[model samples]
Target: MSVVIEQPKSPRSRKAANWEKYGWMYMRASGAILLILIFGHLYVNLFVGQGIKGIDFAFVAGKWANPFWKVWDGLMLWLALIHGTNGMRTIANDYAERPMVRKVLNYTLWIVCAALIILGTLVITTFDPCIDPNASTYLPGVCAVK
Candidate 1:
């Protein structure tokens, strides 16, 4: 008795899209940025002033008041989301065996990731802590308009 194993074709031979190369580059770029953004976020949130104890609704409102922190948070949000999403895509490609299953899972993954990213970015950028504070339980007393 004998058995045979078929090897996958080279990407060049199959003329597959260059998505892998782009994906590799994205990983490296996102990883370096993630390191900076992650550390900076931690430094401010855990080391500034009263440290973690200072984190409250007021603290967040103050932070968002500054354009700098807004951009910082926005960058962190985009970078982390793209990095995580790409990583998950790699995992899905590796684990999903059936063509149909892989396609379905990847489609779902991208749709959900995109939706969350858009919604989160919108919320962060447009957030107004002082908007009808009395109407919302999430608002702090300090944010109520006098």
Candidate 2:
């Protein structure tokens, strides 16, 4: 594939910041990082020890007990959500013929993305494994009895 770089419309004429260019770059960079994060996540959750059978509430509690896993999962959530939303926005802009429809779709897409990112980050950062006292049967190892 041949790539053509766009020159300034006029010689020495500075152009405003190119958002589409940055968005494309972000998609590429986030995709590479998400590749590693996702594979590592899958390997740890599905390939380590008893594999899928061992994945339970306790397994997740234990994993989230450490700060490292929290950050790793958080990064994955944020990157994946944004990457998917940006792709959708690009599709909307390209395919939606009506300006009003494109505008509404882009706005809705970003709104949903922001809401999900906020909620997911809250879940990851504020997750408490020992929230329920009655469900200590499986979480006993991860949580201490009061």
RMSD of each: 5.5, 5.0
RMSD of 1: 5.5
Prediction 1 global C-alpha lDDT: 0.78
lDDT tens string, model 2, 31-105? 999999999999999999999999888898999989999999999999999999999988887788777888899
For each candidate, give its TM-score against the true structure. 0.79, 0.86
| lDDT score, candidate 2 | 0.85
Candidate 1 residue-wise lDDT, 1-146, digit = tens:
22221223325336555676667778899899889989989999999899999998778887887899888888888888888888887887777777778778888888988898899899888988777636345544436444
> Candidate 2 at 61: error in angstroms?
0.5
Best by lDDT: 2
* lDDT at residue 32 of model 1 (Cα atoms): 96
